[model samples]
Target: MSRFAGRFSGRRAVITGGASGLGKAVAARMVAEGGQVVLWDLDQALLDKAVEEVGALRGVALDVSDPVQVAAAAATAQAALGGVDILVASAGITGATVPVTEFPLDNWKRVIDINLNGVFYCCRELAPLMLAGGYGRIVNVASVAGKEGNPNASAYSASKAGVIGFTKSLGKELAGTGVMVNALTPAAFETPIFLQMPQSQIDYMKSKIPMGRFGQVEENAAMICFMASEECSFTTAATFDTSGGRTTF
Candidate 1:
């Protein structure tokens, strides 16, 4: 699939968290398919390395949770890239694993700020660019945990749940505006985000997947590409599952 060409030819994309993990995988796929991608992440060094690795991919150090930063980045990105046609809201973090009753307030807020709020900030700022362009594709990377809440992962679960809701609402609002908004709910994939979780928690998550293993980054990226492509017409305010048989709906 990496050898395939021009799936996203002549398109421009803004991908949050594209420095690594699932986000990087998607960026690679898009660029390989002939799309121009501008990646936004918090780590400048990693973003630089990723851009070099992906070849022709642009990098920006952005904190998506900040609306001011998001707006500024959007303006700069639009100016440089001409305009954004697709947005992959993949920047997120999984806070510490703990029971809701024991969850620290700060951790909960942090998770929400990044995972849920970040998605909102990106869409709120960038969707207008797409809307004005008269075309757009938004694929918000949510989680299966949002559907079937993971025990002891209250903050992560809640943030993702909020994303699902936000995607639906936003999708509807943009239904007739030549833009489609959707969410991808993937079950535990072997991404760097795993480093933030306990091994015990990881094992428990694996146990819930009928596939009996973590998902592959490529698999999720494939779905995202389809969702971000013109072939994804007529699907908005919907949740596409990439959960390895964990979610049939």
Candidate 2:
């Protein structure tokens, strides 16, 4: 709430996949707290709507899965924001929900490209800017499914696991550089990402949470905001769990 007021004064942030769901929620909070944010997503229409709704600096539509597009978008963002102080690599997807043997080859690759590689591209292109500025915070949105792989969601699980690993590696590389990197591993949240899943799978995930309910977008945004803030300093190559007692490790 108002507690975040002025916390991000004069800060510039970029949220990949900010068109909706957790990304949008994070963007809104950043702006509300005096941060200027650029929203990135694949859907042009939704991107426009979110930018308007969130009062972001602007919205850029690009496929996070494409390295070339990601590179260009990063350039555009750097130019637009005059140098990003924070990066929230939240762009991702939940691929087909089927047994590993039944998972489509195309689906697996697509999920990995967006959920994992997309994060790398964002961090790769932006971390240097933070280093140059001598300050930065990177929050990569992963999932509990990575820690404990969910059945029939091999691609999503694998991609998120990669994210967790990547965050650790990047954190070590940026240690003591005023650039902190961390991963957020959350259980199922009632976001649009759930639309891609089967009801059975959704029920299965809910059952895993001790809270017996899905996380709210605001709840997710709260943890992410802290991770992306100066308050999160001294923590890197680590994961912040928000799984409602489902994952203690």
Candidate 3:
């Protein structure tokens, strides 16, 4: 289904984490549907590569956790694209795995800052623009861990849980407005993020999934594009799970 087939022909989008993984997949899909895209990420090399792959799209090196940097990036994106019709906040990190009692404070904070706070920073700066325009869509990438905490991943779970709450609250606040806010709770996806974790941890995660396999970046991207499209008019403040039945509730 081409939900955004011709819908984004003249529209513009801002995608964080667009350098790779799920973000890159979503940005590619958006561009395929004829939208002008601005990709934001912290890795300059990856961003350069993504720009090359996604021809005609702009790329910016942005640290989402830094409010000043996020704000500046948003401004630059708006200036370049004229204005953002869709904002996909996909920049995130998988924190080190360990029991809560043993979890390092620095690691916890880093995870929270990147996964949750970064999303907030983007929203805080971009929401107003959408509200003013009286039309916008925000799709934040969350995780199934947010709904059901993983055994040895307190920081990642908590941060993603925060994303759920944040999305819900913001969605309600903008219910009457034209802007729609939503989050995607995806299970383990075979992305570069997973490469950061140990093989044992990866194996454990895959075992827990009912599908007995990791999710694909394209699968997650499909859902994100739907939520970011104009057709997603009624669904907001909700978590759309793509967890391969890992989260049936």
Candidate 4:
């Protein structure tokens, strides 16, 4: 048997931003471990492709920032998969890199809406389902920027920091219950999202990491899988750093 045998068999997982990057990686791993996954993302074509590639999976088009859509999506997923056993709130965006003074309020709000409010929406909608089931695992995708603010990415940094705080608070609220909530603070990873960033901004991020390289999606996915499993029973309301030594703290 695999070392992770029975880790997630018969479990149902819902991953936001599951069409690509770290979210997709986690979904693939969960299914490999015998779990069913419901992937929600804004990109319908990509989501459909992911669903086709990963057996025992379903895909839904969703904008995480939209409460109405998220609620509807959650209801559909719960109906199809028999409720969520794990939730990975990974939908986010790295907003434009501009000095705080130059950053447009609209851009900042957009970033916060998707990264911070999006997480809240998912948790708010899904937590009740998990609570009813009497078991759940929640892993919110945060960033090293959340812990240590980056120079040119104020909105992204602040939003992710909010995610960390929110996860901690929720974890505490669910204490003594079977549900567990946690956040992962990852350093730069070679994901498609990086392509959206300017090369100079990317270089600045790379220079800060002591590892001299970007993190792998597989590594982040592995960490997430562990956090979502029954094996992660003890830890909750905590931050797990996968920063490749970028964060000495």
Candidate 5:
């Protein structure tokens, strides 16, 4: 993984939810490319360890759903990195799994707050940094559920759908600003995040994938890195698919 093609050399990146799973994988890759990275996650202990593990410049304990935390972290990043060239809004969670009518209101709000609003807050606070530099790449991690709603996961589905829409609007807003915004709609990947789901739900999602299995974290990191790289030039506000044919739209 340390081949170092220098694809992200001298780049500074902040990846929310960089403690583990897909986010963690991306952080490792970016660092291997000679980029400076800061891992942002809600758990202090996890963040501390991930920064060391991924060789990231540092780790910031951030709850992106909290605008104050986001703003403070944005300032921290601005001061530390001086200028950020990449942002991967990958922090999120899977709330309780249940029928919409049976869904807990508290659970719904929590999911939306973290999955949808968190992405918005990070972009809101950090996009200005990118705009100021006149060069940036943002890859918002969404899900195939956003495109094809998953029953019993209403909040998760709706929140991710919001991410896709947000990415589109922001992409266009920064069209000529040298900052590109895009999103990924990926199929279920077998990560610790997947362990949060019920066995039945996991099985259901895997069945939908034409590949007849869940995706790997490395498979996801590959797409995410491409989206975060300078090579992503010419594409903005678009939804890239990694759903193994479960979604082609």
Candidate 6:
């Protein structure tokens, strides 16, 4: 596992939502390969636990949905980490599963604010630092539901779709720069985020994946690590699919 020790040596990374799920997996992978990682999450206890387990990782707790907080945290990260070489915008939420017409207005806004706007806020604040450093990798965690809309999860789907679009636009804007922006579209995964979804919705998602199983966090971390590595130079403004054949398009 430490075979790729030099792959991320001397690199500093920021992983939002790094306290758990796919984000935690990616953070662990980065650290295992010799990178310095700073985890950002809204849960103080989880952040503390992740830092304890990851060892040497710096954890910052803040709501990514707040632009002001994100900006301030990014500044602190620059000072603490010296400069950010990689950013994995992994923070998100799965709002209520009710139909669009019945979807509570508050729920819709909450999902959009966290899932979509939070990503924008992170990129908005951190991209400049990357631009100054002249070397950066940005991987945005989107979902298969974003491409193939899932019934009863309109807000989650829409927010992720916006993430994909935003990645494409930002990738192009930073084309000639050292920054590479891309998104990962994963199929259903058995993460705690499922707690937010209805049972029927979860079963429906599982049935759609041709593999007949949900994705593993490690599987996603592998793909993410590659995308965030120096080896991923030629690709940008694109979406990487980890959907187990659910999205061949």
Model 2 stretches astray by more than 4 angstroms: none
Over 1-249, each residue of candidate 4 has an lDDT whose tens digit, in order, gives 346756789999999999999999888888888899999999999999988887546899989999999999999999999889999999999998999999999999999999999999999999999999999999999999999999889999999999999999999999878999999999988999997799998999899888899899999999999999998999999999999899866
- Candidate 3: regions farther than 4 A off: 1-4
lDDT of 6 at 248: 67
Per-model TM against the reference? 0.98, 0.99, 0.96, 0.98, 0.98, 0.98
What RMSD, rounded to one decimal, does every model reach? 1.1, 0.8, 1.5, 1.1, 0.9, 0.9
TM-score of 1: 0.98
Q: Against the unseen true structure, what C-alpha lDDT does each candidate score?
A: 0.93, 0.94, 0.89, 0.93, 0.92, 0.92
Residue 180 Cα positional deviation in candidate 4, in Å, after optimal superposition: 0.5
| Candidate 4 deviant stretches above 4 angstroms | 1-5
Task: For model 4, name the residue pairs that clash.
Answer: none
lDDT of 2 by residue, 197-248 (tens): 8999999999999988999989999999999999998899999999998986
Model 3 scores worst on lDDT over the 10 consecutive residues at 1-10
Model 2 alpha-carbon miss at residue 89, Å? 0.9
Query: Which pairs of residues collide in candidate 1?
Result: none
lDDT of 3 by residue, 3-120 (tens): 5567678778999999988888888888888888999999898999998897537899978999999989989988998888889999998888888889999999899999999999
User: Model 6: runs farther than 4 Å from truth?
Assistant: none
Q: Which candidate number would show the highest TM-score if scored against the true structure? A: 2
lDDT of 5 at 122: 94
